[model samples]
Target chain A: MTTSTLTHLQTLEAEAIHIMREVVAEFRNPVMLYSVGKDSSVMLHLARKAFHPGPLPFSLLHVDTGFKFREMYEFRDWITKEVGAKLIVYRNEEAIKQGAHPLKLGVARCCGALKTKALLDALEAGGFDAAMGGARRDEERSRAKERIFSFRDEFGQWDPKSQRPELWDLYNCRMHEGESIRVFPISNWTEMDIWQYIRQENIPIVPLYYAKERMMVKRGAMLIPADDAGNLKPGEVPEPVMCRYRTLGCSPCTGAVYSSANSIEEIVAESAIATRSERETRIIDHGSNSMEDKKKEGYF
Target chain B: MNTLDKELFSAVETALLRFTTAGSVDDGKSTLIGRLLVDTKGVFEDQLDAAMGVEDKKGAKGAHLALLTDGLQAEREQGITIDVAYRYFATPKRKFIIADTPGHEQYTRNMVTGASTAHLAIILIDARKGVLTQSRRHAYISRLLGIPHIVVAINKMDLVDYSETVFKQIRQDFTDFYTNLGLIGGELTFIPMSALEGDMVVTRGTQLPWYQGQTLLEKLETAPVTGKINARDFRFPVQYVSRPQTEELHDFRGYMGRIESGSVKVGDHVTVLPSGLTSHIKEIVTFDGSLQRAFAPMSVTLTLTDERDISRGDMITHSNNLPRVEKELSAMLCWMHETPLTPGKKYLIKHASTTIKAMVTSLDERVDINSLEHIAAPIELKMNEIGRVSLKLLKPIACDAYANNRATGGFIVIDDFTNMTVGAGMIQ
Candidate 1:
C-alpha cells in the first residue's frame, strides 16, 4: 500500500493552491499575470483546482510586449478558453507607435519601456489590487528573499530590505489603498518541479519548447529566431536549424538552444543533465543585476 | 510511460527534507550549504565558474564557497546574508531544501520565517565560542515553533585544532541549557563539523576521525522524521464556495479548501464549527478526477449531502472533536515591527480567513531569549521580542492549542492605522 505522505510535486501543488485561495479571500480586485509560459500554465491549472465548480475569481491579465513569438498568441487564446478563465490583454501603444524596437532602443531600455512600463500601465488602468505571477525563487538569486505575498508600493516597486516578516503559513495580506501585493504561488518550486508538474498534470504549453526545424540566424552563440526580422541583426540571414527555447520571452531577446529532444520525456531527460541555467539564454539576463533592476521598475 | 519518465517519477516520490541553518556570522553556514551543493552535483559548471570569478572580488584565496550561496549583490558587498536564501540539492537517495538563514539579531524575524515549517533545524555553534547566545536563541525559537528535530552542529573545528574536548564541551553545554527549557526528549542531536574544511558536512572527512557518527547527508537521508504530518482530527477551513450552475452539473455546490490536518473520505460525518451544523461528505472533487480519500495539505472541493451556511472562514471538523470557542485569548506573541505593542490599542487579529478587531488587555511577561528567564510585567514588546499577552476579541474564534495544531492556533496582528502585520501570536 502507498503511504499517506505527499510527494514533492503534490506538496508544491498544495502550497500554490493555498496561495490562490488567500488572494481571492483577501484582495478586492485580483488578476493573474499570465505570460503563457510553462510556469503560467501550471499556475492556471492550480487556480482552477483551487476554485473548482466555480469560475476563477480573478481575471487573467497579459501585458503584451508587442514582441512575443507567433505561437505565444495562439497558445494564450486557446488555453484561456480551455480553462474558462476571464482574460484581459493590454499593451503600451505609445511604444509601439514610436517604434521602440529591441535592437534600436537596446535591451535595457527596450525591456523597460516595452515590458515593465506596459505592465505598470495595465495594472494602474485596471485598478487591480493584487496580481499573481509564476515567479519562483530558484529562478533568480534576488528572488530567494521574496515573501510569498510580496508587498508592493503604490508605484509597484519591490523593497527587498523592508519586506514584512511572514511567519508560518499566516501571510499578512493587509495593505493600504493604491498599494498592491504581488503573490507568487509557486515561490518554492524549482525549474525541474515545473517541468515535472507539467508532465504529470498534462498541462498544455507552447509548442515552441519542442524541437523542430526553425528558421534562425546565429548571432553570437544564440539562435536568433528568423520568425521576426526584428530578431535578426544587420548582416544576418535566415537559415534552418533544429532548436527549442528553454524559456520564452520577447522574440528579439529570448534565445533558443540547439536541441533535438522534442517530446516532454526527451526534454526532461535532456534537462536533467543540462549544465546551462535557464535564465542564461535570455539576452536581458546577461547584464549584471538586470533582473533586480527590472523588478525595481515594476516588471513581472 | 517511457524508461526515463518512469525513473524520474520514482525519484519524485522521495520525501523532501526541509532544514534550516541557524548560526551567527563566521560560523560558516554559507560554506556548509555550498559544499553540500557541490558534493551532490547540485552546482553546475557555469555556476562554479561564476563563483570562481567572484573569488577575487570577495578577497578570498581559493573559490570562496560562501560566494556560491551569497547570491545577492548586497549580500556579496557586505559579506553577510541579509535574508533567507533557499538552496536545493539532491543525492540519488533523497532531496534537500536548505533554508540558509542569517544569524544577525536584527534579522531574527527572517529566521523565524525560515523555521516556521522546517522539519529539522541545524543550530550551528562555533567550536571556538562554546554555545553562544545566538545559538541558544535560535534553538529556543525552534523549540517554541514545535520543530520536531534539532541538530546542534558544532562547526569550525579546524580553527579549534579539531580537539574532541572542545566539541564535547560545547555539546554538553548546549544539552544542559536545552534540557532545562523543559522541552520534549528525543529531539536533540549533536555533531562536530568544520564547514570551511568540508568535514562531516556531506562526507566524513579524514580530519574528524575521532568522531564516528554519521555524516550530515547520511543523517538527513536516514533520520526518522518523527511525527506524521496528517495524522489528526480533520480540520478544513472553508476557503471558497464553488458552484458553477452549468447544464452538465446543474445542482453542484462544493466547498473548496486545503485540509490543514487529518483526512476525510466520502460518507464521513462532519460538523461545521462556528455554526454547529452537521453534514455528511458526499463527494471530493479535483481537476483531474475525484479522490476517494484526501488528507492534509491536499487542496480539494467537497460537497455535502446536507447543505448549510458554510462559507470561507468556517471550519469543518469531526463531530466528536470540537475546538474551544472563546472571545478572550491568551497567546505568546512575537513582535515584528518598529511599533511597540501597547495594552489598549485596537488591532486586527487575523486567524485563518477571519479577521476580528482585538485589543491587548494585559502584558503578562517576556522571555529573556538568551537565559530563558522570565521578565515579569514588561511594558511593551519591541521589535523581535517574544512575550506573553492577553487579548480581548470583539468576535469569538474556534481554535485549538498551537501545540495541537498550528494552522488554527496561529494568528497575526494587523495595525489599525497602517494595516501592516506587526505581531505573530500563538494561541496558548
Candidate 2:
C-alpha cells in the first residue's frame, strides 16, 4: 500500500481507538453490550485492538429475550470465552413466565419489556454507569440522531429529539447519579462497510447467516423458518428450501430470504446485488416502525 | 481480496475524519459522493448491480449517484435525503466518514446533527449559483460547530464550462463570508469540478486544464489531522471507583475513567474537582498491564498515591491549573426542542462529569442566520435556531471555555419532565 493510503487507514483506526479509550475512561462501572451479531462481534474485536496486550477493561452484557436462535447462543459463548470477558446474561423471567410471546405482545412491546426493560434492570442491578453498543446510524431513522456518548435517564429511556451536540472528537459522557451513557464506537459504519470489514478481518460469524437447506413457510414477503417460534396458521405447510437470514434478531420476528449463496464470499456477493434493506425482510419491523418505537422505550 | 484486506487494514490505522456535504438541490452533492466512491472503487460489485437494476427500471441519468447514500425506500422514491445518511470510504491516505446531509431548509436539524461531530465540512457551491442563503447558513453553522477545516467543492463545473473566472469569483465570496465569521483558523481549499462528469474528484480531469490543484481524493488523503490532543490540562472524570474486593488484590483501589485532555503520569500531582482534594498519581492501570504515563483519549484506571475522596462525576486535573466552578454561566445554546427555551424554565444541566438542575436566567440574544446578527429583543429560540442564554445551576459545576476545552465547556440541557435533550450549550 502507498504511504498515503496507509496513513488514511491509520486515521480511522486511531479515531476508533480513541473513542474506545474514551468509553473506558469516562463511565463508571461500564460494560460492553454484546448481541453476538456481526456488528457486535466487530465491536468486540475493535475493543480488543484498542487495548492490545491487555484484556477488555469491561465485562460483556447480553440481554437475552429467550427467543434467540440456538446457533447464536453457541457463538455468544465462544466469543465470550475467547475474549476472556465476564458475561452477564439478563432476562426478564416475569415476562417469560407471563407468556408474553412476540405474537401476543407485538414486536415493539415484547422487545421493550423483554429486551429494553431487562437491560435497564440489569444496569440498575449491576450499577453499570455506561453500556457500549454496536448500533450504527445507517440501521434506522432514530439511530441517525444518536450521539457517540448517548445519555439515558434514571429510567433508562432515550430522548431522540434531544441529544447532546457532539462536536469534533470531544464527547461528554458525564451524567447524574442513577443515569447511564450509551457508547457506540461504530456509529459511522454502514451495512456494506460492516460486510467489507468482516471479509477483511475474517471475523467468524454464526453459520445461520449462510444459506442452508431448511423447512420454511412463506409469510407475505418473508420466508419464516419452520422452527418452534413459527406460529403456523391453519393449513400452512412447511417446505424445504435454501434460505438465509440477512439480519439475526428474534426468530419470531426476523425473516429469511431465499438464496443459493452459503459461504461468506457468496453472502458478500449476494448482499451486493440485494435491492431491499436488511430490515425489510424482518417481519417484526413490518408491524410498526419497529426500531423507532423500540428506541423511544430505550431499546438499543 | 488481498488488496482489499490491505486497504482495509491501512484505513483502520488512521483516525477517521467525518465531513458533511452542503449544497443546493441541483448542486450535485449526491453525484459528488457517487463519483468519489466510483473512482476510488469503494462501491462493491453487488452495489453496482443493484444500482444497475434500479437504472434499468427508471432509465435515470447520471448513474443515479444519489442512490449511493439515499438507502431508504422512501428516500429513493422521493429523490431527496430527508434524513442524514452516513457513507464511509477510505483511500491510501485517510479514511472518510461523509455525513451526506440534505439541502432542504426544513431539514436544518438533520444538517446540525451531521455537522456536530464532523472534523471537516465540505460546502458544495454550484458555479452558477454563488453563495446562496442556504450555503451561507451551512458555512456559518460549520464555523459555529468549530469544524477545523473547510473544503469548497465548486461542483458542476461542466455546466459552467470550467471557467476559472467564475470559480475565482465564487471562491472570493465564500472566503470573505467565512473570514467575517472568524473561521480563518481552518484552512480553506477551493477546487472546480463536475460531479456528473467526474472532474477533480478522485482523478485529475482533462477539462479543468488551467486548474492546478490536487484531486479531491488527494487533498483528503494528505490533509493534516489534528494531532497530539494531550497538550492541554488533564481532565479525567471519575466514572467509577474500582475496588475488586477480592482476595488476590484485596487492597487494590483504582479511579477508573477516560482522560479527556492532556497527559497523566505516575508521579504527577492531581487535584479532584468540586472537592479540591489533591493526590499524587500512584499507578496508571489498564486491563492488560500498568503504564508509566497515560495521555488524552486513553481509558485507564488511576491509582492515587494518597487515597482521597474521589468518586464518579468528579473531575481530576493538574493541581496547578483548574477550571472555574460556578453556578451562573453564560453560554451560546442551540435550541433543539419544539418547545422554546424560556427564562426561568427549570431543566437538567449536564456538564463535564456532573449533572445539576439549572434554570434559564436570561435570553441574551438570538442569532439571525442570514445576516449573522444577534437580535437581543428575540424572546424565544424556535427549533434549529442559535441563541445566547445565561443559565443558573442549582450547584457549582466545573467548566472551561468551549474554545479551550470542548469536553469540559460543552453541555446539554434536558427537559426535566419529558427527559428529552432540549438544547446544547457552549460555555462562553
Candidate 3:
C-alpha cells in the first residue's frame, strides 16, 4: 500500500521535533520556557515526543510573577510531575517586596521587573545558551518578522533592525559566550492551529480555559477575576458569571470572556469565528506598539 | 462542534501552501496582501480598527491596507518594510502562509530569506512601470532560490483603464527577460488586477471580466504540493541518537532524524555514509507507534537490524542512489554580512545536521543584479552580494546539487569569531 502524505498538523509536529533536537545537539545548556498555557502544554508534549524513550535532556523554566490564577499553579505542578522533567520556577521576590503591582506601577514597568528581568536572571543563573519558547509569529505584529532562532545579546535584547537572515529549515544556532538564542519551534503556527492540535492530541489544559461560574468584576472593558470580594470598592460588587480565558497570564492582567463553550471542541469552534484577537484580552498589551517595546526590553 | 466546523478543521488539515511576495513599496505588495486577508475574513475587527487608526491619522480615504503589514514601530515611522514578515490566511480548500519580503536593493538578503522555502513566488509589478530593473532582480532571485512556480502579478490595472494590452506586454517583457536567463521547466503565470479596487485577488470583480485566467487565490490554492525533487533518493541525516537506557529498553538504540527527501520502508537495506557501514531497517518508530514506511519531511526513528557506529552528522541512504561524497565543492554563495568574504579564511559550514570548518578556495564571479551579468574573479564578496565560489571542507559531507534537493544541498556560513550566520550557499 502507498503511504499517504502527512497532514498539516503532522508537518508542524515534525518541524517542531526537528528544532528541539537541533537545540539539544548544538547548545550546551538548553531549557524549555514553560508558562503553563495551552501553547506551553503543546510545546511540552512535543518535547516529550522529541526524545521519547529518553527523558527530556533540558529543564523547564517558568518565570512566576506571583500573580497567576490558583488553578494555573495547580496545573503547572501537576504537569511537571506528570512529565517527570525538572521544573525551574523563578520569582522576583525583591520586586514583590517593593510592591511592584500592575495597578500601582503600570503594566509595562511591572512586567519589566517581574517577568523580563526575572527571565533573564533565570537563564543567566542556569547558564543556558538556548531557551525554547512557544512564542508564535501570528500572536502579534512585531513577532511576525521574528526568526525561528531569534538571537539575543548579552543583555537579552531583541533588535528588530539587525536580526540575522534566516533561510530554509537550516537554522543557525551558533552564539557567543554571553549571548543566547531564543528558539521558537512553533513560530509558524497560528492560534487556530494551537487549539486544533490541542483537541487532536488531547493535551491537558488549565480549567480556567473552560467556561465555569466564577466571581468576576468588570474592570473597564475587561472582566477580571474577583477572588477576594472584600477588595471591592464602593458600589463595586462581584457577580457570578460564565467566563473562560482565551489566553492565560497573570490573573490580574488577563481578562475572561463571556462564553458557554466548556469543551475543547467548542473552544475550537469559537476560535474559528473569533472576531477579536486572542491578545486583545491581555491587559498589558495595550497602547500602540507596546508589545514591540516590551519585546525589545527582553520580555518573552 | 457542528458539521461545518468539522469540515473546516478537516480542510485546514488537508494541506499547507507557503509563498512569498516581492515588490517595491510603490508596487502595492502590502496592499495586495491586506486585500487578500480582508476579503478572506482573516483580519479581525480590532486589527482593522488599528489599521483604521493609522489610516485616519494619515488622512487617507478608507483604510490604508499597507499599514496592516508594516507592523513594526520603526517600519510604521519610516513607512517601509525592513524585513520579511509572515502572514497567514485560509480558505476552505487550503491554508496559506505568506512571506512578505521587502523589495529594496539593500534588503536583497531579506528577500532571499523569504523566497528560500517558498514553493511559489509572487513578483508584483506596477502596470504603469511595466517590467522594471528591481522587478527583474526579484524574479532572478526567485529563480535562483529554485521556487517551483512564479506568478507575475501585474497590479494597479485600474490606473491603466484595465487594458489587456498592457498586461500582455508586461508579461511578454518578463517572459523575454526570464528566457534570457537560460531557465527551464518552472511554471510562469501573469495576471492583471487592482488590489485597491479588490479585483482579481480573492474575488473576480467586474473590471477583470476580459481576463480568463485563474485568480491569484485560485492559483495558490490548487498548486502542486509534493514530489518536486529531481530524484526519489532517501536521504536521512542523523540528528540525535536516542538510547533510552531504561530497564525495559536497555538495548533500544535508535537513530533519530527527519527524512529530508524521498521515502524508505522497513526491511530495506541502507548504508550509513561517511562510515560506509550497511544495515537493514528493522523498525520505523515514532511516539505513537511503529510505521512500516515514512516519507520526506517526516521525523522518525529507525532501528537497524545490525548495530553500526553512527552518530550525528552521518547520512543514511540506499546504495542504488547514494549522494555525492565530497570534501571540496563549488557553490553559489550569497554574502549576508557587512564583513566581506575573503578567500582562504576558515568559516563554519552548517549543512544538514553537521557543522564543519570550510574555507573559500576562490571567488569565481559575482552576479550583477541590475544587468544579470557575471563579473568575473571578484576578490571578495561584500554584503548582499552573490558570487560563485569553491570551498574546501575539513571533512566529507554527502550532498546533492541544490536543484536536486534543497534540504540536502543548501547550507549557511557561520563566522568562527562571531558565531553569526554570515552567508548562504547552494551547492553547484
Which candidate ranks first by TM-score, i.e. highest? 3
For residues A1-300, write the lDDT of model 1, one tens digit per residue. Answer: 234777778878988998898888878999999998888998999988788767788899998888899899999999899878889999889998999988898888888888888888899999998999999887767777788899999999988777777776777888888999999999988777888788888889999999999999898888888888667777899999999998999898888999998988778777777776787778887666467677877877
Candidates sorted by DockQ, best first: 3, 1, 2
After superposing candidate 2 on the true structure, give the runs of residues whose Cα lies further than 4 Å from its correct spot: A1-34, A42-72, A78-133, A138-185, A190-300, B1-8, B41-58, B71-82, B104-109, B227-230
List runs of model 3 lying over 4 Å from the truth: A1-4, A229-235, B1-3, B54-63, B227-231
| lDDT tens readout by residue for model 1, B145-262 | 7777888888889898999999888888889888877866437888898887778988888898889888888888876542425367688888777777888878888887888878
lDDT of each residue in B227-269, candidate 3, tens digit only: 3433387999999998889899999999999999888999999
Single out the weakest 10-residue window by summed lDDT for candidate 1 chain A.
A1-10
C-alpha TM-score for every candidate: 0.95, 0.75, 0.97
Q: Give me the overall lDDT of model 2.
A: 0.74
Ranking by TM-score: 3, 1, 2
Instruction: After the best TM-score superposition of candidate 1, give how far the Cα of residue A86 lies from its true spot, in angstroms.
Output: 2.8
Question: What's the distance in Å from true for residue A137, model 2?
Answer: 3.5
Clashing pairs in 3: none
| Strongest candidate by lDDT | 3
Give per-residue lDDT, candidate 3, residue B208: 79
The candidate 1 chain B region of ten consecutive residues with least summed lDDT is B54-63
The positional error of residue B273 in candidate 3, measured at the CA in angstroms, is 1.2
Candidate 3 vs. true structure, TM-score: 0.97
